[model samples]
Every structure is written in C-alpha cells, then in structure tokens.
Target chain A: MATLKQVAAHAEVSVQTVSNALNAPHRLRADTLERVNRSIELLNYRPNRNARSLRTSAVELIGYCVPNWPHQTHLVMDQFLHALCAAAERTGRHILLFTAPPGVDGMPTYDDLHARRMVDGFVLSQTETHDPRHGWLKDEGIPFVSFGRVWKESTQPGPWVDVDGATGSAIAVRHLYDTGRRRIAFLGWPKSSGLAEDRVAGWRTACKELGLPTNGMAVRCREDSIEEGALATARLLDSGRDLDGIVALSDVLALGALRELTARGIVPGRDVGVVGYDDSPLAEVVSPGLTSLRQPMDRIAEELITILTGDQQPAERLLLPELVIRGSSAPG
Target chain B: MATLKQVAAHAEVSVQTVSNALNAPHRLRADTLERVNRSIELLNYRPNRNARSLRTSAVELIGYCVPNWPHQTHLVMDQFLHALCAAAERTGRHILLFTAPPGVDGMPTYDDLHARRMVDGFVLSQTETHDPRHGWLKDEGIPFVSFGRVWKESTQPGPWVDVDGATGSAIAVRHLYDTGRRRIAFLGWPKSSGLAEDRVAGWRTACKELGLPTNGMAVRCREDSIEEGALATARLLDSGRDLDGIVALSDVLALGALRELTARGIVPGRDVGVVGYDDSPLAEVVSPGLTSLRQPMDRIAEELITILTGDQQPAERLLLPELVIRGSSAPG
Candidate 1:
C-alpha cells in the first residue's frame, strides 16, 4: 500500500516520472522504467498502484443524465453535450448517458450507477436552487460538477462552471443603446428561475446607467417559447411603451418577437432592433439573422471536466458571453 | 462453474425463481430464496453465476461516437440520442459517448473503447455505403448496431435499424398530389449519397405512378442546407417547370425553400405546397408550420437495443416515417 510518492522515492525519480514509467513508458529511458518497475515490485505496490493502473488503462467514465424535454428545443444542450464529449475525450474519459424512468427524475439511476461504481463522477445541467441531487450526492460523498450553478443553501459547496447571464444581457443593452436605441425593452421569462432573473438583472443595471426609463420597459413571459415571446411583444407594443429595441433572454422568444413585428409591418433592425441569447442555429437561419449572445459552451465543458477529474476542492467559474452582432441588431 | 439453469435445477425452482432470488429477492418467498442460496453453495456455482451476476448488476454500456458537426442542426440526432438513452435505460444499459480527435473520424476512438472493454457494443449513425467502421468492427469481432444502414459490399453484414426514406418521400409526394397540386417538384441532394438517392427513388416512383412527368421535375442541390435549397428552388422556378408543389429531402432544405418563396412574395401553402423530412422543431416554429416526415426514432432505438443485447443474429428493421400534416401542406 505504498503511495506513488513513496514509490517515486524508492525508485529515485520524480513522482511524475514514476507515473510516466507506468502509463507512458516511451517518455522514460529504459533504465528509469526498469528502476520504477523494480521499486514497484519491491514495495509491494501492486495492491494499490497496480490496481489503480489497471483501472486507468481503460477509459474512465463520467455519468450524465440526458434531459428529456421532448417539446423543448435542445440546441444549447446539444451543443454542450458535443463539446463535453470532446473535452472528456481529451482527458481519456467518456460521458456515460442515462435517463430516468418516464416521469421521474434521475436520482435513482444516479444512485444505482454510483453504488455499482459505473462512473467516476457526474456532470449535471439544468440544476435549480433546491435540486435534491446536489444535496443527495453531497451527502453520499460523491464527486459531481454542474454546468450551471447549484444554487443550494449549504455549508459546503459543489463545483460548477456557468455563463455570466447578467453580463450577457448587459452587453446586449449597451450594444442596443450605442446603436441609436434610447428605449430598450427586456423580454424575459418568469422571475422564479434564477438563470432568467440573472439576465434581467443585467438589463436593469445597464438601463439605469444609460439613464433610460426603466418603468414599463420590461415584460415577463410565462415561458421561453416563440408564442410566449410574441404575446409579450404584443403587450409591449399595445401599451404604447415606444420601445426602439428589444433584448430577449432566448432566441426562441426573440424569434417570436420578430414574427409579431413582421406581421405588423414593422421591420426588425430598421424600425426596432432585436437581440436574442444562445446564438443557436436558429439565430443564423432566421431571416435578417438574429443578433444573439453566444455562451462559451466548449470552454465551460472543458472547465467542468477539469474540475470533475482533477483532485482539487470544488471550484466555481463564471465565463462572460460574447455578443454576436447580426442583421437584426444592425444600426439604422 | 455451474450455470443459472443448473443452479435452478439443483434448487428445484424455475429459472425465473432463481434469478428473482438473486436480483429481485422481494418477488420470491423467503424459503425459496433460502433454498436457492443453499443450492448455490452446495453446487459451488459462485464462480460462474456470481461473476455473471456481478457484471449484470452494474449497467452495461453501449459506445456511441458523438458526431461533432458544429454547423449542422442536430434535431434528428438529438431526438434519437434521447430516445436511445431512454431505451437503453429501460433495459439496464447506458450509452457511453466519445468524440474523435478534431478533424478525425471516430474509428480510432471506437477501437480504443472496444479494446479496453469499456463498452458491450456500439450504436452507429450517419453511416454511409462502404463505411470502414462496419468492416473494421466486423474484423475485430465486435458487436454493433447502426441507426443507419451500413451499405458495405461485404458478405458479413452489420445489424441496423433505419427509417424508410424512400417511403417518406413517397408519402410526401402522395400527400402533395392529393392536396390538389398537379405539378410537384422534388428538391434533393446530389446523387452520391445513398440516403438521398433512396428519397429520390420514392419521389420518382410516386411521380410516375400518378402519371406525372418525372423528367425536369427533380432538382438536385450540392448540399442539404437552407441556402442550397433556396438556390435549387430558384433554379426549378427559373427553368419554368411550372411546379406548384415542392418536396424537400430535409427540413433544412425545406426551410430554405420557404425562405426563397417568402422573399419572392409567394405564399407557401397557397402559391406552392411544401413538405419536409425529419419533422424537427423548426417544422413547428417556422412561420407556416412545415409538413414533414417524422421518423420513429424511439421505436428504432428500442429495436437497436434489442438486437445489441439479445443473442440473436443481426437484424434489419426499416420503420416507416409518418407524415405530419401542418400549415405548409394545407389544401388551397
């Protein structure tokens, strides 16, 4: 049961060199590899280090629960999953995907997989303030990293990497303001969602700094969908808010607003600037192209995998989203 | 090393009774469970059955190469992946996702995962004729099932479950024909792709059966994208083909056609009937809901898992795509 450092000491080499001797022998001289192997045998390290080596020889697996929202568009999650797979592969790990039984959350499956050692750790997404999985996994002393904030009230914290939604909205507001837009309205989802509220905060801060009227300039939708967005836009227009720009929290809502504007013969970009978030494929495909904020999904995935695999205490990373200007946000 | 059947015989119980004793003990009577355990010890069946039970106790994993087509919209694959994950979970398996190195295909990663015993089998998609992975996996004596056909010219074939693209096109054609559209045109990709050709075949067959002119009715695009589809639609129109309906091979192409028609002040349903394949979210979100063919992804995933886990020989399943009628194909 000798530690890797002890094996390194016995072999008269660095700990990294001992690891290279076992995992990447080509990186070491023949004599060094021989010395490390000799030390490993003499110290009876097979029980600990050899077993670990055998496990490492195969691909390590990280479990992810595939969210089943059939009616919802999954462009963001789809992009993130692809990026996560690429990031995990770079570190010799793979993503093992599971789904809960119909109408159930993924806790039971997570428990079963953890109990049986099917995964080294987990990568979570779509987490909320009171997600039971966070507390449950923490209580079980399991390793996990979420793509979004855990938002839990606990003495201990979980690792996470999230996009700066507030900053994304702030950037959108500033861009719209700089483009001759004095009155910018925010189209956002219900405030019950932490993620949605974060975006709204950005809009509020940016509007107040720009000395623009904030009263009656923001509209909340029941959900993030095209229909809801259109309905909210209709309310903004009918209320005589005299808005010249609209910054929607998601592309779906933005597209909905565009649909309403087009129906009323009001040209987007020319008459009323419109911007959305996520920069999904729909953004580019939509006519006049959608001005959107693009989250750094690849970088976030890389960070998540790093935190999940590295033997470090939990880390929190908040990355800024980049505003991608398109025809919809073109200055008049 | 005694088998489960032998253990059942020794315990004077049904095979299900013995299995329940090990896996679902609550389903068995206390005395029956005791008898099964006693028989297992008496016959020294622990070596074989215990190992098998232990292996099954942990979730079996099916390897999937996460296709990294960043620009392409992945509605179909995204839906299929969710379905596959759900289906795998129902049968006590999971999907292990790996991505190939940037700019590389997935063969190397697949071989690595298979060599390490990290997965029980594979589920492939985006497969093409003469796909090297099929031949390579066959040579390696690995188990795999493709969501698409492996059109390799080999005696030993791979198991696959594919949606009938030809039938999908035929259904579109027939639907368009029945909807008072006398002249139906086909917008499809170049002939090099086996899948595109299959779809074209359906259009051709249906066009001929309905005694419609096949010549000069089909237009081929270099790729299946919105832009290419628009260009192809333009070509079809400028050629004076007098087509009143268009059936696109994919939703992207169909959306492109819609964009072109809308730009030219031509209404979709009234001026030119349109239908698309893959019934993606775009089909619903598009201005005029697109009438498209919906692939039975859930059923296909179920069949693929059944073939992969069962000891049966390779099976080929060709499920039909259902045409979902919507605004784009409404009768005028």
Candidate 2:
C-alpha cells in the first residue's frame, strides 16, 4: 500500500519523479531512476494493481502455461520464473502461472483463460515430445512461446526459447572428465521427458567421446524426483557397479545420489565425485555444497519474454552453462 | 486424441456403456463405475480438456499468485506444488503460477486479468502479516482463497485455507521435549512472514508450557535460505548457547542445519534432536531421513476451490498438518 508519495519521500524526489520511473521510465535520469527504484523496493510499494490495470485495457498480464498433464510437473524454476518476472515488469507485463489437469481422461486443459481470452499470450513450460498444445495454439493463432521446442518443431520457430539441455548435460560429463574422474557414471532420467532424454543422450555421447566404458555406468529413474533419483542410485550401487565419478542429470537426483553415497560412507568430492544439473538452490546448500551445471535461468527468461513480446525472434538460443565447482566435485 | 471409443476398447465396454458410466453416472451400476474409473486411470486417459471445457465458459484456469513481492521464500515447498498441481488435475483445475511484482520497483503487481476479467479467481500464496490483498479482494468481491492466510486474519470472513503451521510446529517441538530435549533452538525465516513468525511463536509457547528455559530457545534467520540456516546453526553453536534440540522452519534449513551439525562432528537426532518443517521429498531422501511437518496442500486446494465455486459464505479454513517422524528426529 506504499504510495508514490511515500516512495518520493524516501528518495527525496517529487511524486512526478517517482511516477516517471514507474510509468515513463525513459523520462528520468539514470541515477534518479535507480534511487526511486531502491526506495520503492525498500517500501514494498505496490502501485494499486486494480487502478493501474484499469488505465490500460491491456493489463500487463503475461500468462504461463505449465501443463500438469500425464505426469505431474512441479515447476521448480523459481530462479527462472522469478528472473523472468523481473524482466516482464521491465516490459510492463505481469505473470500469471497457469496449469490445470486436462479433465476427461487427463489431457492438459486451460481454464476459461484460453476460451475467454484471459491472456494476451502464453509462455508455456515443458513442450511435449509431440506437443498437441503447440499445434492447438498454432491453429488458434494465440501468441505464445514454449520454454522448449516440441519434437516435431523445425528450427524451433514461433516464439519459443530454451536452455539447450543436450549441451548442458555434455558440459556436466565433460567437467567430470576435466576434473580427473575418468570412470564417469551417469544417473539419468528413465522416462520420456524430452529434456531429460536429451540430457541422457548427451551423457552417452560424452562417454563415447571420452572412451569411458559405458557398461553399468548409467542409472535411470522413472522421474527426476529426489526419491526416484536416490533410490535409483542405491539400486545401481547395490547392483554392484564400479563407478568413480557420478554426473546426475538433475539437481534433485544429484541430491539423492549425494545421500546414497553418504549412507555408504562415501565422501562426495573424494570417494565418488558428484555433479548435478539445474543448479537449484538446494544444490548449493547440501553437505558438500554440490557442484552443478548452472542453467542461466535469468538469461533464458530474458530471451523468452523478448521473443514472446516480438522484441526478438524465435531462435534456438543455447545459453552456455558454467560448471560451478563446489565441494561435491571439488578436486580432492 | 483418446476418445470414449478408445476408453471403451481399453475397458472392454461398448461406447454407449462408457458414455453412460461417465456422464450418466446414476444410470450405471456401482460395478460399472468402479471399472470405468479404474480403466480411466489405467489408460492414463485424460479426456480431451477442450472438449469437456468447450461447454463451460469457465476457461478452467486456476490462478496461483506466486508471491514474488520483494520478499524471500522457502524452496522445498515448491516440490509440493507439483504434487498439488497433480491433485488439482484430479479435481479438474489447472494451476497458473502467478506473481505480482512490486510495481516498477519490486513491490507487488497482479495480472491484467484483475481488470480485464480474464481469470475466475486466484490462489494467493505467501499471505503477509497484514495483507491488503485480502481486504481489496473482499471489497472487489473477487473470488480468491489464500494458500496461507494473512496474519491477524483468523476472525475475518475469508475464502482462505492453509495448513495449520502453529499446530505442526507445536507437534515437532513437543516431540523434542518429550524426548528430553529442553534447550531447543529454532532456525528459519524472517520476522516479516506471518507464517514463519507463527512457527517461532509456537516453539516459544511450547517451550514455556514444558517449563523449559528460554535462554537457548530463540528463532533466528541470518538469511532465509538453507545455506543461511547452515551458517546460522554454525554461528549459534559457536555462540556458546547450550542447545539440545533445533527446530528449523523449513526442510531446506533443516538440511543445512544437519550439514552444519555433522560438519562439527555432531550427529543429528542423536547428539542434537532436529526437526524440520515442510516434509518435502528431500526430507526422505537425506540420510537419517529428516523428521518434518507435512502440509496438506491437497486439502488446502480442495477447501479453497470449494469455497471459491461452492455456495458457501466467505470463511477462514485451517487444515491440520502431520508430523512424520523420520531418522533425523528419531525418538531416543
């Protein structure tokens, strides 16, 4: 409920100055803009949403559709969403997270938003291998972009953007090799998620190039959950695989793998080096401070909104993931 | 693409019978209903969402207002959101992750739907201490149920529903006290969050009731993160307070606290009794699995939606949480 006037008081500026920084950004000096912004955040100022929205028949609402179809999707990219949200505001758009179980048998369904024109367009998550949603959106000509491309997508046209999973996974395996871990093991996704599958493929390719023995070096899970990942790791070890380095396909699985290793009295960075993907905050907090492939969620989000808003074109943008060497994969 | 004919084929029933069983439930026998339901799940059948929603103007969109209004949030609970999304599908509502940033600054903002009338209502998350969102929604008569209720709003007429945080925290602390740990430390969230503050209050009240000393019992958050929690735990131990039990406000924090305890060569649940909030999947994956509080998101969602669409007066609702005892806080 903090107002522009309050923000102005904190920034030692006039109401108009505060107003310009918010509405007419180009009108203010750069330093003044910075000060005004700092004051607003400091005050927890929310310009009356309803009233501001009333001014524009188009309320800066950006709709996100993360289909909770077939298997449930948790949508853990807060780092991505949070960053994209900040970028969307820069474009004067607000985000509305939209997901629904497709009723009937359970296909992905959108509530009245799609049918009633509730959104200007959508930023969808987890583009299916053969996405019906993509075709439907194309047929309807609704403005939208996928967080990833569908299997059939040629050149990933039509406002879609993504973090290249194939490249990221390869980078993870390559890092393990670089860190003096020759016998690398991949604990990967078992199911049919395009991204997960891509990571697995990347790992296989990395192993093939490195000339590492692929036999019994791979662990799979029906899902990328911590339980599935942990259980899979345990199962793989119990199955008696000789592995020196482990590169998990996801942060969750990495955490799970970390636990499994811990239970067996294995030191992560020493006994069996570990590396995770997604670089979720959990990766940073685990005991060994997990080494991970950092997905530039902010960069992807930046490009996603840019493409969706027509400021940029639909391009298969690959943001290079940097390997954060933490204690889990810290050189012993 | 899967139709009633396909469902009938899978279930070995005629299309007419399948239709009768699904739409005309009263016309079907009890055995038929059970078979159809079982077949529906077995086939992973999701009735084409558009077809089912084609009749209702409801657009079927469920808005999730992900609180990104210039504040820190916990991470583990996000995994639960995936589960909740799955649960919502069972009930036929899609979840839209919504975030209203704080205006141009980083306060709070909502969707254009707030004005354009695009969405049915909202599932507001991170209820503040004195949330004006509740008041505004009430004034506008917009349907919304909070994921967690605003602090100081127990008596207000509400369409809000949430897990009983106080009760959950009390359960964890009482368990600790029963196990003969009197000097307990609470780690977690900032004082701003009504929910976190409530957890701290619950810990304090429980400690006083058990006639334990208040010296070592304190709620502190250097930062609202697991790394923060770990660092805080380290600092707390270093500060030379006689601490026997620790109740972390979140699973991520508890994980961090566990790491901190172990780094000091202290065994969690043995040398120190540790309890965590949010029995996230990681709670089970960690070695010496974390004993944590479970929030009933499904219950929260069900009650909220029932109030939103159901013919019920606006009233507050609270769902009791479960204390899942695991290895992290195994009773001695």
Candidate 3:
C-alpha cells in the first residue's frame, strides 16, 4: 500500500501534476502522464473508491431486503416476490435480495447489512410499529423505502407504501351485512401481524358501527392456515353460534372455511355466505367462486420504487382495494 | 467533471500523488499529502464510480441479477435469499441486487458501475436460453457465478447451482405408480420454462420407464396458482376423464385440485390420491394436508453463495427434491 504521493514525491512532481498525469492525461504533458502511470504501477494502487464520487453514475442494480415475512414458504409472499423481481427489471434496477431470520426477542442480524453496506438502499416489506431496521438504516445512513408503514404516528418516518388491508376487510364485512347476514365471522391470521391487526380492528369496528355483534361469532379465527380456518369453522358450528356470514382476512383461509362448510353439507351462497381478501386470483377459480377484495399491486410496486430512488417523499397513499363479487357472496 | 489528473497538474504534482492525497494520504509525506489535497480542492476534479467503490479495498461485492420473476411471487424466496445473504456475510462478501423490467431490453445502464467499477463479481439467477445479460457480462470480463446455467457453451462460463426438476418429477410419478395409481394425471406449468419443461419431460419419461399410460385425465396447467389448479381439475372432471391420481407442479395448484375434488363430492386422499410440488407451508395447512415434493432451499442457497465467492468452482450442482408424504396421498 505505498501512497501515490510517495510515488509523486519520488518522481519529483507536485500532487496536481500527478493527478493531471494520471486522471486527465490529455491536460498534462505526455511525459508527465508516463511518469505518473509508472508511479501508479510501482505503488500497485487500485482505485477502490465508492462509485458515487464519480461524475457519471450507473443504475446497474437495485435491491430488496424482506425481513418480516410471515414465513419462508408462504405462498402469497412467494408470488409477490416473484412479481417484484420482474417489476424491478422494468425500472432498470435489479433486486439484491436479503433475508433476516428472526432470532430470540424477534430481532435478527439486520445491522450486518447496514454495517457492510450490502446493497444500495433496500426495499423493506411488512413494516411493524417499531421496526428496528428503520432506526438502524438512519444510523448507518443507508437509503431505503418500505412496502408498508412502520408506525401509526401521524408524522411517520421513511417512505413507505402498503396494500389497503383495513379497507379491504371493512368492505368484505360491509358486503356480508348487505346480503342480510347479521352474524358474520372474520377468519384469518392470528392478531400478531400489523396487517392482521389492521384487518381485525376494521372487522370489529365495522360491526360496532353497523350495530352488529362485536364479539363471539363476529370473529372466529385462530390461525393463518387452511386447516386452522376449517377447524375454527367447525368449532364455531359446534359451539352452536348463530353465524350466517363469513369474511376471511385472506383467500387461503377463506378457502379452508369453504371446504369445511361444503364438507358439512353447507352451500356457500345459499346456506351460508363467504368473502375473501386478496382476491388472490384464486377467488375466481374456486367452485361457487368467492367474493373478494383485490389488492392494488401495481400501485404498491410503483410507490416502493419511487421512494427507494428518493424520487418520492413519505406520504400516505392508499389505493382502494376493489371489491369483486363472485358467486359465493353474490347477495343470494 | 474536472479530472483528477487536471487537479494534479494544476497543483504541480504527479497524478499518483493526487490519488495518494485522496485515497491513501497517510502513506504519503505529510507535506506532499497537503500539497495534493490543496491541488484537488483547487482543481475540483472527481472520479466517476459506483458509491460502493469508495469503501475499503478487497471489495467483496457479489451482485446477483434476475430476469424479472413474475411467477416467483408465490414461491417466497426469503428463506433461500436470506441463507445466501448470511453466507456471503460470513465470507466477507456483499450481494448486489439487479432486475430487468418490461420496456428495458439488453443490459442495464452500467456506465458508472461496470466502467468505473463497483463490484468484484456477480451472482446471476433465472438464466435464460440465450441470456442477453450473459453475453454482455461475458464481454465485460467480470468474474461471476449463477444460480442457474445459461444456455450454450461459454468461454470460462460461471458455475451454476440449480434444483434437479427432472429427477423430482420422475420420482413423483414413480411414487404414484408404487401407490398403485396407474391412471395418474400430471398438472403443472406449460412446457416453456427450462425447469417446467424438465419436470414435464421427467413425468413422461417416468411414465414410459414404468410402462404406465400417459394419456387422458392428465392436466397441463398454464399457471401454478391454486385457482388455476382448481379450474384445471374442473376441466378434467367436466370432460369426464378418468383420473385416478394427480400430480400438481406446485402446492397452490394441488390445493386447488383438492378443492375441486371436494366440490365434486370426491374425497381427496381416499378416492383419488393427490400430490404437489414446492412443499409450501400451505401444503401442511390444508386439511388432509397434501403429499408434495420439497426442494432443498437451504442447500441450494449455500451452494450458490460458496460458488460465487470462489470457495468452490462447481460445474453444476443438482439438488434432489424429496417427496414429503402427507394426508392428501394417504389411502383410507
């Protein structure tokens, strides 16, 4: 690691002359260029400086760091990530992917990425109330954006975009009520996730606001899986609760409920009614079909990019989740 | 931008001296370093480079470029990507993310990063038959590794680590036959993707090898969505085809197939056995569960990282997808 100045001193020239000879040779005498080049070779120097210092820049890559995914093999997230990868290409940004498995106390080695400067700003998904990644990025001064909001505060930190989970759930519940269903049930994930919590709150609030039951059969979900949904449905039925309508937080759970109902000789539209969220393209494929709320995928994708690139500021952009009415909850 | 050499010349020093002043000042004579620094300030010359280059030498950046993964959203690559990222960190390396979008064709703008030099090598994913990125990267003469192999012969082509799709499919078919399922149907993506094509080929080969019938009731699905799977199942049933057993390319599709069977008053595991690939968390979530093949995500991830870091130069690594027996394929 000999210094370029040492070489310059050895060559009996000022540093400016050395810089001119090495970087802007045309502005320097040919002999000066030759001497400076020889000095650089002698020093065995490699320009390991950050690319930002350069006048011309490269948009050769982009990156995403999803740490709070529900699970590794989750079917829904799997599909979203795939779409993101494809979408990244459109922006001339490639996804540098990273995962931080939760450790004890629900914290992972997120600082490792920040310390080493892994990728250019990251695309963070599944924001929580007090996400550590947000503060860590600020301390490390790394650029990043989120797929969901990190806090419930009025003046939130960071640029983030998210699917309208609350609105979707509210719409589902509203639809069920409209179909003359008084006792509606909400099925889906445990109330641990921020998104799930939002959906749950919306369900309960809608019921209370609409003068419907706020507890008991109003919410009968125990978990996120299809089996759990089915098992929960069976429990609701066995408990002799008067539930006539159902709104699941997710299509997968809704599907499980449907299976349980069908097995019990219950027809979705006639005997009981159901509505699913995510519209998951699966709603249309299911028999009797399913009424669902479709997420605004393109808008989320676009907003995420804009924020990550510093092209957009922190703003609450909520796109309406479309209510798709299929056979399952067609007001029959 | 004012060139470093111009600064050096203006400051009356060799370019090496100027570089030493900015990049390695401590190694130069204090007086000389001061002179170079003063000259740089006077000339205001800057180098064009990726922001990452400015970090310490021994650049450990290993970029991974993907060709838009729209279909991958459901696959939840978090576990795999996280493992790879963790491995890279252990070996003192970083992963760069890059994606190619719809309108953008050929290589992304790499003027600053590639030309000015940002990363040491790359880790490419979703390699196509004749990947344009491959040719362009090859021309740049950058050392790289791949999670998938590019088509055609290349001079000093990078190493690849991919799942053995053909083997997995064949095993699935054989398992069905072993279970006394002679009229088993195949359900999966169209024969386009190299991996998908391999699975189809393997299914056919396995059928032929086992002397089993390959016609009728077998479904060729266009997508791996659960809804698509259900629709395909409905199609087969509507056609009145005799399908004793079914193999879906993905867990989502298999779940859909199970739903269709339920709708038609058919017991999934008892009446007609069903199997799925991907072993998604959803597989275990569904009632009667699902018999599926599981890809070794962690192993593939580790292999990709090791190869990219030059710890190993594997020509191509093939991982076996194991069959996870579940309730869906259990005979009553």
Q: What TM-score results for chain B in every one of the models? A: 0.80, 0.71, 0.75
Task: Indicate the residue-level lDDT of A309 in model 2.
Answer: 79
Over the stretch A156-240, how does candidate 1's per-residue lDDT look in tens digits? 3678889999989989999999999989999998878788888999999999999988899899998767778888999999998
Best by TM-score: 1
What's the true lDDT of residue A191 in model 3? 52
How much does each candidate deviate at the interface, measured as C-alpha RMSD after superposition?
Answer: 3.7, 8.4, 4.9
Q: Cα lDDT of all candidates, in order?
A: 0.81, 0.70, 0.68
lDDT of 1 by residue, B82-135 (tens): 899988888878899877643336566676566545788898887756777777
TM-score attained by model 3? 0.70
TM-score per candidate, chains pooled: 0.76, 0.61, 0.70
lDDT tens per residue, model 2, B1-332:
46667889887877766765655454567888789878888777765444333323323555665555333435544554555555555565555554565323222233244433345567666666776766666665567777777677656545777787777778888999888787888886777677887788888888788887666456577565667777888888888887788999888888888877876778888888888887766676566789999887667666767776666476678788888888777665
Chain B TM-score (model 2 vs. true structure)? 0.71
lDDT (10s digit) by residue, model 3, range A274-329:
98887664566567788888766666777676667655455556667888888888
Residue-by-residue lDDT tens digits, candidate 2, A131-239: 6666666555667777777764564546667677777778877777777888878888756666777777888888899898788778777766766777888887887
Indicate whether candidate 1 or candidate 3 has the larger lDDT: 1
Q: List runs of model 1 lying over 4 Å from the truth.
A: A1-59, A101-105, A150-157, A227-244, A258-272, A311-314, B1-59, B102-105, B128-130, B150-157, B213-216, B221-244, B258-272, B311-314
**Docking class for candidate 1:** acceptable
Better of 2 and 3 by lDDT: 2
